[model samples]
Target chain A: MDLATCLKKMELVGVLAFATVDSDGAPQIRNISAIHYESDAIYFFTARGKNFCRELLEDGRVQILCYTKYKEMIRMSAKAYAVPEEEQAKWRDIIFEEQPYLANVYPGDTRSIGIIFCIDRAEVEYFNLGVNPIFRDTYTLGGGTITKKGYNITEKCIGCGKCRTKCPQRCIEEGKPYRILQNHCLHCGNCYENCPVKAIVRE
Target chain B: MDLATCLKKMELVGVLAFATVDSDGAPQIRNISAIHYESDAIYFFTARGKNFCRELLEDGRVQILCYTKYKEMIRMSAKAYAVPEEEQAKWRDIIFEEQPYLANVYPGDTRSIGIIFCIDRAEVEYFNLGVNPIFRDTYTLGGGTITKKGYNITEKCIGCGKCRTKCPQRCIEEGKPYRILQNHCLHCGNCYENCPVKAIVRE
Candidate 1:
């Protein structure tokens, strides 16, 4: 529903899938749970020698995704960076304290080979499919910006109701321009492609 | 355990997370379930206008990930392409037949707007965290080549057994030049980082 609720849902989902681009421009993904969540940011741990670490260092752009049992998808798009050298240990310790299972993977001094990366700003998208028409929205954490999407009806609408009929969610309503209920829109582009007068424009 | 079995597991898991690189080289991900699987290949459907489709058209590279409840992660790294024009309808029909729920989303003629993508060759990596020492291995489907990973001990091994002690899996054996049991290896690189004689090399 909001940035805080989305972050809470991600934490409740536990392990999340993180995606990043490799040097070859190919996408790589792995499940990661060694994370410490803050009110406005997230810090996660990865071994320094791992490809996951190299990918993060070479390309800070990353996407974290989680699908809850209730069919809610919380996706965070952000750039990740290694924590400040002086603060790495603090964050790493906090994560380790939270995820005790990590101790089995890197015991004792071996943890020194690990590094902590932080995502301080992100555009969090919350998409819920559990309801009838579906619901979606974007929120910013730490002042991050969101990319505008979906379709809008222009004033050129002849009110033929073609777009409304084709809309899967039936979110379009009768008006001067035929209002599209953004909250329930699927962004499936059905209405955009079916508009007879070409009045719908992508936002 | 093998490529075929892994594919079956993914089918059982239903919706999978697909990760791709956008035109700006940033990572993007979405959940996809409109899939049809074969013994050696996979076919999936997505809207032609979605960013996921554009990314595939531009870069072809993709990673399909599914995490099972038993803690097994099956990741398929491959290149995807729009099915040939003549064959698109065939694959699309098969997928829609397999996934009846798709009808609710794109009823009647609306399904024509969707495009079918295929991955005929892939390198599948199976990591099972549900087991002790974390079993992992890679397999190829449709004659795909795999990028070797993890560490190997070279002939320069001094047999000091330091590598074995540091190995979390204890999979390294004492020998003239220590051998790493690839099947049980965690690939954490602890043995490689601590090798005093620099006998370890990444595969």
Candidate 2:
């Protein structure tokens, strides 16, 4: 299998999971119609004045999950903002292609009909969904040479599986500082990035 | 081909490409092996203090490219940072796992290991060798929804191929305002994000 085939399969069978914070700081998750990939950014469209869009404006941070029923997943984190006008017309055509009905809604005024969000940071996790536990591959925003260092357990790791669950490498064992499997680890740092206790240290 | 198969193949075949800045603010491309991917973050181990690491601390902006010999490619933009101490030991284990010989290099004191750059912003473009064209994807930082309205072309477009080359959808047809192929558009806004002209407007 090639990267293109995997990506195409993800596109064909994968569902995108979105996480956003509300005005009150409450986290919310929703499934969206599409997730667009670009050379330097990721884009998605929604209502012009929805809460989701407002949240994005207020806080540019966001996380997107794309997974297939087969257990393949890609998790990405990024900052986002609305696309500008001169750029909207070109994007609008993209929207129309995805949802032809959108063309009728905005017709000559596609600019008023949709919004585009650009991703600032991205991390992709590719994993198998079998009982046999195949292999996993992770890709980060920078070139592949860069690695994420996890934190040491400074009496901070409360044994919460948040990091474990979020870890693409599945390296953080289920216990304290929670032992990390260096062999299988991809160094994604989800444990370090999402640690509630801030216990994990880099070196 | 399944996702696992694709990843396995990528692991054996992926080539990491690096982006550096020239004196004129133009990006330069290079290939190196020090690059490695964790689940979602890209990591590299450099001397505790180097010119590149120093520059990263100041601006945190960088780009990376990875493509297979067959031409499958993924390009990303991101901010880079050095890892703090206390977190070094754990990552030391990680370093050893990936490159066991490095273990001999930093016997007891890992502090001498220098800096590790982590990339946060990420957008990916997937292109195949002879087929599959190109597709783009982006990962957001937190979690949320994106929307927009009232966008029109501004007079800023200089018709450079930067946006076209960066466009994930490849919708921009390279004309005045670059005609967008609305049918296959994902609205990921890589065009706007990378536009040298800043001609793309959201409102």
Candidate 3:
């Protein structure tokens, strides 16, 4: 599908997934209920003095996951920082509409009521759940679009099954020599990078 | 809902989100397609040699985002590391079932496959999205039937809007006293922890 088509579908039924770091440098994930998607940025809210809030201020890197009800998912990696007062005032109404209660709270607090992410780069992957025989056939006939990207299993695998366990698609099989179920693989490349032996290679 | 009911509801409907650090010490977000709930840990797959894989290997500190298709969302902070090889071999069949093509793949090749992430500690936040007034009322009325935890905003907020932009809920509002929209809040605490002034206080 085209970008506009994908975006429209996402806007209609998209769900936002978030991942952030804690004060101790551990990762955290949550679902966002309200997200303001701007051409250049996105915005959301949280309480004052949270660990994640501190992580962002100390380091502005962030990742956003947006998926459609139908399974299409998009991942965005960006730098996040606080919005200045002048900018916050301009977007106050837009922010309030999405979150009405904000109008009542945060009247005299010293804490910031908002945060923004300025996207530097984004990687989008679109998938259709139902069968699309036509596209499959075309790709098949087209000699299977060469994905120069392939995984290399190094000597460091250590025969560990951690890859098998963590695979969202269950594509890794543990045996004499670990095997990867390519057809079922989403190419997220978790296995390649996580191997203790550096067995899996993506090139 | 009980664990069984919650698991059933999440069968084909769970969203997995996570964060990892780059070489520069900045955090990045990534999404997992499927999450396997084992006895005491959660598993998902990615290529073996990616940045996240490297980050996890070097520092097992990680966080997770798991939600039930919108009915409930949970954020977890945990430590993760690779599993052992002998154990991995035992689960080979189950992994193969999920990825049938593994049979055709090589096992001993250095650039083949491996496992990652065995969660150690975790915190869960349950968000109930039931439309029925009964479910909502029960929780709202303090019936204790629906369970959830609350957080407090600290006195460290410096009025920075970083949390607002990074929030998935758009619950933060920027004003003189900056405030948060608790009604729609998901309690992800992106704003609270990311605030420059450490304003967000989690109770």
- Candidate-wise lDDT, in order: 0.88, 0.50, 0.52
lDDT per residue for candidate 2 within B1-203, as digits (tens), equals 22233334434543333444423232223222344456555566654323344445654555444444453444454556666667655554565577654443333443243456665445433333223233333333222122232223356777777766654434567777775554334444545556777787653
lDDT of 1 by residue, A97-130 (tens): 9988788777776777789999999999998876
Tell me the lDDT of candidate 3.
0.52
**Candidate 3's fnat?**
0.47
> What TM-score does chain A reach in every model?
0.97, 0.62, 0.55
Any residue pairs clashing in model 1, and if so which?
Answer: none
Predicted structure 1, TM vs. truth: 0.94
What are the runs in model 3 whose C-alpha is more than 4 Å off? A1-10, A98-203, B1-12, B49-52, B69-71, B98-117, B129-203
Listing every candidate in turn, what is its Cα RMSD in Å to the true structure after a full C-alpha superposition?
Answer: 1.9, 18.8, 10.8
The numbered model that scores best in DockQ is: 1
Q: On residues A140-164, what C-alpha lDDT tens digit does candidate 2 reach at each position?
A: 5533232343334456678877766
lDDT of 3 by residue, A7-119 (tens): 45545654566666655565655555445655434565544334456666776556566666554555544556666757764554566576654544433342244554333
**Looking at model 2 chain A, which ten-residue stretch has the lowest summed lDDT?**
A142-151
Which stretches in model 1 have alpha-carbon errors above 4 Å?
Answer: none
Q: How far in Å is the alpha carbon of A53 misplaced in model 3? A: 3.2
Which candidate wins on TM-score?
Answer: 1
Which tens-of-lDDT digit does each residue in B115-191 have in candidate 1?
99999999999998777777898999888898988788999999999988887667888999999988888777788
Candidate 1 docking band: medium
TM-score of 2: 0.37
